[model samples]
Target: MDVDFLLNKGKTIGLEGLEVYMVETELLNLTISSDKVREVSSSKTFSIGVRGYIDKRVAGVTINDENLRVDAAFEKLSSLIKTSVEDPNWAGFPPPRKGFINVICRDNRIIHTDYAETMKTIKDLMEIMKDEAIREGAERAIVAEGMTRLGVQKITTANSEGVHVQDECTVFSTFMVLKTVTGKGESDKSFWIMNRRFDLAELESLGRDTARLSLMFGGGRKIENGEYDLILMPQAAVGIIASTLIPAFSALNILEGRSPLRGKLESKVLAEEVGVSDNPELPLEIGSRRFDDEGMPTSSKVLIKDGVLKQVLHNYYTSSRMKLENVGNGFRRNPSSPTTPYPTNFFVHPGEVKLEDLQREVKKALIVYETIGQWMSNPFNGNVKATATHALLVENGEVKGPAKGVLVTGNIYEWLGNKLNGLGRETFTSEGIVAPGVWVEKVKVATE
Candidate 1:
């Protein structure tokens, strides 16, 4: 595709500024069902997105055209711009910037791996799950379904402002849901693992854990409704924090008065032991990137430090609208979509509190492994209400039994502030949220 041609054409057509974003992706996929290989396939896609500004009226168009239909895209964009209302705060597209930090976003191995290798990985993972289930005395367990994906994407951003940048990244991820039957009942659990690099050993470990947990959650019984101290595993902790607290740190939400964290910068919003950051420069993580979609350089920054709200995330639009410096957090789900503020890789800093020691110290806490309905959490008012689908009762520093159908509800501010207990010494990342196990005191738990 000729980006220069698009920019020159837009100028001749009376457009003040123009931007072109292109993505080319190649993906290899393998799906499993009922412990059998359901499908194997490969695909390649080319997408083009164009955004233009005409006298303070901006419009964009996105198309999956491998042939590069410049004329059609421009016609649609022109029509949309003419029908759109002019924005008083409209600014031109961002110019090119330098000093982009180096981040490990690509893995050559994933790109080179073939279909046979991916299928072998799936088979190995299933065998590991079976072995783990047998060791856990639940040999009746079987893999209900799963998928493995290896993909590489090439992203190019070019605009009339003389900004042209390109990036390439690779991703390998897999997930499996295991189901088991026991004398009491049937239970199922799922495990997901993703990274820039592919490693079968690591996937095997996750598979084993999934199998063990599925068995543990079998024959679950309800606990009494009352206040109990809680210990959240890394997955559960990430789920709650990502849904309840992370969105509130976006400058877009703050400016629009849709965030509870508005006007709280530099304030002590969480416990002193709590800290959070957005570190896109971290190596081998799937979200690691050196530049955002707008060709802005990316860097690691602290959002919360020593319990104080240190920095808020910003994209170019939000920061410019608020008259604040752009921190390079701006991203778009697609090229034609408006830029929004989002963390590349959000992390809750780990602490020195060991999980075993913390569990022993809080002997009667409920250990929550996974949750559902977290997306229903309200970020504007900081209200969190989610059901703990996989949890266990712990007493005297030992697992008592499975506790299911537990409804955990609370306000985010209260849970991370006064009710906070401690954070585990180790950290894990799932779906771009890197966090340690989180503990809170006297949390309200409801059951039927």
Candidate 2:
């Protein structure tokens, strides 16, 4: 048996009744390759985590071994049971738990040694992209894909008063990223990619198109900073929105004085039409899970409801601290779960206009794509001072070609929020999230 277990220890010091929760084990292993060479390889680990509540304070610790020093875990928790300064609503353990439903899993599937199929699929995908690149005038291109298999078994238990649970789940998936390079000499440029489901043929096409974008960058020049119609790719939109604004959905962040969305609960955040959610139900995604690590069922949870802030993601502690509902986002990668606020399977619902339509509406505007040195060049302010790998100068409803040595610098929120003119019909669901392309106004563009 590939068994990993956790030993738990605890002592209650208060009248509120002490409780201890333990997760027995979780397993994982995955292999990914490219160009017939394996790039990512690893094996599963059996691990354990223990959480203890004493005098309204919570502490947790984790270990991975056959002879788990459960008592030692408690010894360490001695220092961890410090009082939290912030006040939270108290809504304790879930009532009447029925482990995850429709949890997609299969036995013997975890041992997939399908190197042949992986190579063949990658070859086909690269070939398709190579041909597409030639058509778009690129001399060379490279493509890569990463596949993963996830299997985890979790068990949660409390010292009788309530809560004892366990569940198992597994998943398999793959993702591709393609890059195409073009031009000659000092004019050489590259276009990155377009998001799509894991398909090599489509991967090739995206690479080709991206390369085409770089090649087209010859005719672009600096345009003054001002308000103009705008069209944004899904990647660009997500880059800005996620980094600048989305972190506030955490009840932890709000309580900790770390989030900008603090004190704005039940208020409007995004545009009225904007609604955000996490759907573990997405067909295939890295974030898909049978149940939250705490053995809580993960169902659809609406974060921003028609622009109004609704519920926030929570774990057992946060739910216990703040008498609010849990959104089932309690996820801990290691068994000793240290509560961290994060997003899993995030998404921005798409609008109805297609990319082509948004482009036409630009009508003498700049199409910004591919930002580099986003963290460095922006000086940590997330004011993306980016050079568009495939930026185009559009005029009178036509693509007038590309720009080079150009820089776009500005606050993502101010530029995107007030200027958000429209959104695209299509979307990319990669890394377990989705953000359709967007259209905005008022940007600062310059030539280097």
Candidate 3:
């Protein structure tokens, strides 16, 4: 699309390379609470982001003048980069793309899961929770809020390398957090299910069962502090491992004085069973992209394959500094961090054990029904101290009483490197990882 613009600009003002990249994102969200649609929102944004070279002066700009008058914005951006400090490490774009893989193979028009479908899904989910409460003693269940989001993005990258590609991506996600109130006590449960296409229908059971478990722990009591087997759910695993573990393997974060695994590539510092990889080109991943933000083709980089410390996530800049190649994980959470690198839908290979089997194997481990303050963990040290909610007492390898008033404290690295023992049969598909449930040998827990 911008090939014509770049070529025209080339004739007017000769340059080594000229590129105009455009990214279009459309989001449709539906939020409901108590069987009533609270909000229906739709939005779209187009960014005419350009990167080009003019006599060793690498300039870049994103034209966001929404009134279709972005040409002025482009001129302003083209002039703004002239004032930037010369980046000696900056490199031109990669070779032209050979071809493209239609990541969004399905009909993009059907990607939006509207309020009607989303509300129906919630009704079914509530029914499951109501059934669970009937098993208990609660008369009725109220969902504080239930929501689903559908997003579609079209990315076009055209550069002087004879590469012109446009790829479409769509992601569907649903999240629910509910509280089950009883005369004994009230307990809360949070659940988030996401995928490239799987929406609320794929999460009915999870939404219901998680809420059911919340009601079961209404009257929680305190327990003593000792080493017990710790059970992790897949979403919990992503919240735990994906948060801390990412720091050790982030090449961009490493260069920014943030990553812990700055100098430990190809080293065995983690459990042999733990593995993580990035393949956004994966069949259906929320974070998958045909090319990273900088137009680098994404690749399959093994970060912790079979716990051997194979490699770390990388982008063009970090790869050049480390004297390696790009792996296409350039993460740009917002415009402020365009070059920032992060994980796509990171993959964690599950062990041979099944979810039910893992539950049976843990004879007396305390299944941490929920953990608090995962975000508070210090990735530099992996030190985490948090309270446990809906913590269940699994006795003789069977879940016993739904315990409460418990707290967990430990370093994630030590917890995963030494305390972790078996992988669960059940795996969770989330925005960034397909992590499986993992069992840890011991954790310091205190009951109130």
Candidate 4:
């Protein structure tokens, strides 16, 4: 679609501050189950999202129908904007930025990847899982489920405020679940790897590690309910930490009185050892982007430094309303949705202690590997209650055995603030959050 034509058409129709965002995506997907290929599919999608100021009120519309005419879509959008309700806090779009940091967000190999290559990758991964399962003494190792997705997306934004930017990115993601039946019992574990670049070696390691964890899942025992030291794996830690902190960092949530950090800027809210930031320039990360949906330049923003609340994320609307700098966190699920501040490549800085060293310091603890129902927990109050699907009991700085059907419950704010014990030196990235294993001093754990 011609973005300039859309903008000019809106202007000619008496629209003010018109903007256009177009996204074109090509995607390929494969799924496998029980060591057999189940499905293979590919698709292409084009969507145009338009926003304009009508009578000083902000309104927007999205056009996704491939057969629909662009001119007719523009006319419909103009009519809707004319009757849209007025927003008292409506501000014009951002002015053109001078420079944007060049981010390595695309991988040529991924973009050019074909269906044959994708199938080969999945088969290789399945073979790796089988070998790992045999090494772990499982009677049989089956790929219970596996999925591979590859996509390339092109984003273009043009606005009457003299903002015009276009960028393209490639994404590769894979997930595998290995089920092993040993003489002791049967267990299953899953692993996920995603990035802008494809690395089969990393996926191999993920499979091996997941299989090893599953092999250690039998011979469980119930534990008494009491306060004990807890070590959260990177994936587990991200699930709990991100769910609790992401909401609090949103300027929109703060404005709505739904955030604990609403008025706590510059205050120490976390432990002195903790620091957090939103880094969109991280090399080859899936979340890296040069600009936001609103054509605002993206950059690394430190939201917390040495336990103090440093900054809250903002889009143009929140930044203008609150008289603050826009850190380029503006995001929209699609063109039809309103833009809001959201994290891009959010991370918690790793500490000096290694994972082995941190575990050695724990006298009595539970090393939680996976949890269920973490998203249902409340973030505003920092409350979390999750069931550990795979956990290990640590006694006297030694891993005793697996502890299943256990409940790990705690308050995120308290654990990260005062009860924080240590952090692992090695970091892991999953689901857009990069973090290391975290240890907390006191948490309640019991068998279900």
TM, every model: 0.96, 0.74, 0.84, 0.95
Give residue 326's lDDT in candidate 3 (0 to 100). 58
Top-TM-score candidate index = 1
Number of colliding residue pairs in each model: 0, 11, 7, 0
Q: Distance (Å) between predicted and true CA of 194, model 3?
A: 2.3
After TM-score superposition, the amount by which residue 117's alpha carbon in candidate 3 deviates from its true location, in angstroms, is 4.0
lDDT ranking from best to worst?
A: 1, 4, 3, 2
Global CA lDDT of candidate 2, please?
Answer: 0.56
RMSD of 1: 1.7
Q: For residues 1-448, could you state the per-residue lDDT of candidate 3 as single tens digits?
A: 3447744664355557766677787877778686455888888888766666655567665565454554564565457556656767666555654433345333343375665665566567766765676566665566667787777777776667666766777767777767677877676677776677654445666865776776767777767678777777666777777667776677867777776676767777768877777766666667666676656666666678767777777766677777775547665544323355677667887876665666677777777656777777788767766666657788776767777777776777766687778777677777767878877777877775
> Residue 348 error for model 3, in Å?
1.3
Candidates 2 and 4: which is better by TM-score? 4
lDDT of each: 0.85, 0.56, 0.68, 0.84
Question: Residue 19 in candidate 4 has what lDDT?
Answer: 85
Better of 1 and 2 by TM-score: 1
Error of 1 at 263 (Å): 1.3
- Superposed on all Cα atoms, model 2 deviates from the true structure by an RMSD in Å of 5.4
lDDT (C-alpha) at residue 430 in model 4 = 70
lDDT for 58 (candidate 3)? 71
Worst 10 residues of 1 by lDDT: 63-72
- Model 2 bad stretches (over 4 Å): 1-42, 65-113, 142-229, 373-389, 405-417, 446-448
Best by lDDT: 1
Model 2 per-residue lDDT tens digits across residues 1-448: 1112222224332323223344443333333334333543445456556555554465666656664675565567656766433223443344545646564333344334354554565556556655665686766655444343334334554432344455444444444444445654122233233121234454455555544554555445556554455566776665555555455566777777766567767987566667788777664455566566555667777877777777677776576667666646776656555555456678788877787766666566777665554443332233555665557777888876665556666665455355666667887655566788877676766666
Write model 4 residue lDDT over 1-448, tens digit each, in one string: 7888788888788887888888998889898888887999998988888888876676777887564476777677777777888988888888888659889989887877888998887898788888888897988888989888888989998899999999999888888888888887888888777778777777778877888887888666777778789888887887887777787888998998888888999999999999999999897787799999888899898999999999989998899899887758888888756788898899999987766676677888998888888888787877888888888888888888888798888888888889988888878887568988888888988788
